[model samples]
Target chain A: MRPIPPWPRLRRGLEHDYTILTVREDIVADPRTGQEHPRVRIDCGDWVNVIAVTREDQLVLIRQYRFGISAVTLEVPGGIVDPGEDPALAAARELEEETGYVAGRVVALGSVHPNPALQGNRCHSYLALDCVKAHEGHPDAGEDIRVELHPREAIPRLILEGSITHSLVVVAFYLEHLRATAPR
Target chain B: MRPIPPWPRLRRGLEHDYTILTVREDIVADPRTGQEHPRVRIDCGDWVNVIAVTREDQLVLIRQYRFGISAVTLEVPGGIVDPGEDPALAAARELEEETGYVAGRVVALGSVHPNPALQGNRCHSYLALDCVKAHEGHPDAGEDIRVELHPREAIPRLILEGSITHSLVVVAFYLEHLRATAPR
Candidate 1:
């Protein structure tokens, strides 16, 4: 494993639809380095993730039926950032639109790949704090999203027992833990 | 948010093409109570995840180009278990196929939702240890997956800086943390 493999993407193709979420395709180069490689490529995507913390120190969460799993799931408020939009702003707008809360400060926690293999999306996570309830909720046409608040410490128990299942929510909590405890 | 809101299925869809991650409609009666709700539903497909650890106390990871994000991703060797395939068996096969390493023992860590909202995939994780190089590497199509070994502690560093962006990888590391620090 000397000089860990360098993944150089030769090129990419990008397009999007103005739907509930936008999907992009990246025509990437293969990384096998010379000598008769397989002549192959891949595509990936990003997702914008938000961690909205309320004034009472509770996390503001949205429970909605995810069309993918067909299960009613609880997740931190977030969505795909439009192609030209800043992810942090997208996080703020999504949190407000989905949960009706406004944050006084928004900090970039980190970014993640929702799935790094066959789709194109990045999950940009943010820590929104000192939130204030701003507007009356207006869920989209097919949205059955309900809001929920939970104690921060109870996260581990929920994860261990199969309560919170959303990928972004779990990662957000873990990132929060890292921020709260990691060495500066 | 007193008493968390009952989860209800608002929409449903099915996806076969990996790119679109499409959603169709499947409505039931009662979402929380399992009663029938006549509505359109989206069926997010199932997903599989694994955490493969080797005997050297290092993790066996695959660094390959994932088309979805158009980036080189470093992840544990894993993929969706074929229909009716035992998760542990799938873990072993994935480990061997992706990294050319075989496991001596496989343990079930847990299962999670990648994104309970848009994905119906259940991310199943496994802990494989006492592994040995079993054969020459064989990854599917244009996969320049270089298998690397990482000391367990390095996981935290990678996650904090956003190198380890895959949700399944983070949860597997968390599962590993629970095992290492939990009462023996």
Candidate 2:
């Protein structure tokens, strides 16, 4: 691997605040050219995606209308991690809040930048196994979410067939699948 | 699933422009509350991710410093899809430009929203098999990228062990792996 060059940030400022997302502009000195260039960065808070698996080996999923794409997308239960909240706790909270499921065990899958090229936030993924419906789902006021459960074996098929299209959600399931199938 | 609600956009305007990304604000009527809300949208062009595989069964990967995170990341060959350029063509072009590898076959794996909650662009993923290095890589003026190749078999381990942590890149490889193992 090549050494990481110094990308010096000359200045940064919040350009716009839209509650959920803040747009920031940064002037950085490009390592390759030694010239300053302005770049836009979206500062969305850290998010959590939970692959909650039921005792029956089913995956707790959600179908919701994404306003950006204006389409109902099937994805794993997840949401933004509230300020100062632990990612694992956020995962558990989102799973229960979005699907009414409680996980017996919450394990970290991994975290990744949703889009390193532009967005400045980490999306932490988790595997919540042995989930059970403990209460009625209580989605946020703006969220019209439908909870669904599917056999865990059907996830790959769903992804391949284009049913699950959220990149971070797909990654959460992929990590869970890898851990489940790894040779001991 | 509930019928898709009408998310009527009342107004939209560019909030800021920073070369690579343009920030736009949209006033839309919230479906659940019937109240207008201001949302920031990052207007990045559609991007492409390529899983370029050599005849020797190696995956072409790149190491680059991401300015937003200020960390070196190991990701598959990819870049922004030029305006009016086909995603497949952009995938092939990015592979060649970033790694000097040309694929014999370029197949669409899938497309996903980088951040459905905010970003308004799709990232098209592709599988480029039987790739061969035909020329030297030509990274852009600001990009200092290093190309590397790894055995295809090591991809799952790399992903599971957290070597490859870019969400979109992981999704691209996951789709490829699923397609390769699916029932014919």
Candidate 3:
């Protein structure tokens, strides 16, 4: 397979900052041709998602309204990873804050770039086993979330029926499935 | 579960057009509180991804350099759906354009918003069965892609090993898995 050579960045500058994400424009020289073009990149901070499995073998999920699509989506616990913060810590913090669930063990599932075509960030997925409700959830003012628990086996069916349509949440479940089936 | 009310859009305007995606800012009023805030939304065109399964039970895949992440990614054949074009047609066109393969039957898997929290578009996944090489591939100027075929059953392992990390492509496969396993 012929690998495409990396483009040489001629110049880059920040275009906009929207708190959650920042946009940047870059002038890069195409390797095949010396010509240059301007490309825009969205810098969404690296994020984390946790599949919190309770001692009863249920998965903790959240249903919240997302403004962009204006739909209340059923999803797993997730949030942005703060700068200089470990992704696992962010996963644990988000899970607790969104569902008031704490896991005894947080194992790494895997990571994926949410949208490598335009977004510059990775989403790390973790499996939080033996989770239990530690306290009442404390969601931020902008976030109005309701938590739900489902048997682990029902996840694939939920995904198929579109009860959970978030792509990253689906990825987290896919990783969990792999981890469960993989020989130790 | 308590469903959060959708925020009211007080005002909206296009902030930036980056050719591939347009960034828009919207002033939204909180449903509970009467406060408004400016939030950014990315308007990317609807996209299509095809899971092309050949007569030999092989999956047609592509490896290409993605500028946003600066990495060559293994992914399913996909591209933006042209304005006024059907997503199924776009899936067929992209499969042939990227891998020179044609399918006897192209079935709709389902659609999911790539990132509904910030992006306003849906990605439709398709199952192209009995695929065969129709002609030589025709990649666009900016696209440097190489095609590869893998045994259909090897897909889950590919995804588990981080070889296929594109979230949407993984979603396509997940949909295909559901389509295969669902009671028809």
Highest TM-score, which number?
Answer: 3
- Model 1, range B74-100, lDDT digits (tens) per residue? 788887677788878988888888889
Rank candidates, TM-score, best first: 3, 2, 1
- Judged by DockQ cut-offs, is candidate 2 incorrect, acceptable, medium or high? medium
Model 1: per-residue Cα lDDT over A1-184, one tens digit each: 5433544544444544424444444444444543322212222235677888888999887777654564567678887687688888988888888888998999998777766664456678899999889885665544556888987776676776677777667777777777777888
Query: 2 or 3: which has the higher lDDT?
Result: 3
What would the per-residue lDDT of candidate 2 be over residues B112-177, giving only the tens digit for each residue?
887776776888999998999998788777777888889888888888787888899998988887
lDDT of each: 0.69, 0.85, 0.87
User: Least lDDT summed over 10 consecutive residues: which range in candidate 3 chain A?
Assistant: A1-10
- Interface RMSD score of candidate 3: 1.3
Top DockQ hit: 3
Ranking by DockQ: 3, 2, 1
Q: What's the TM-score of candidate 1 when only chain A is evaluated?
A: 0.78
Instruction: Show the lowest summed lDDT stretch of 10 residues, model 1 chain B.
Output: B15-24
Q: Worst lDDT window (10 residues) for model 2 chain B?
A: B1-10
Give the lowest summed-lDDT range of ten residues in model 2 chain A.
Answer: A1-10
Error of 1 at A29 (Å): 8.5
Which portions of model 3 miss their true places by more than 4 Å? none
TM-score of chain B of each: 0.78, 0.92, 0.95
Please provide TM-scores, in order, for all candidate models, with all chains considered together: 0.78, 0.94, 0.95
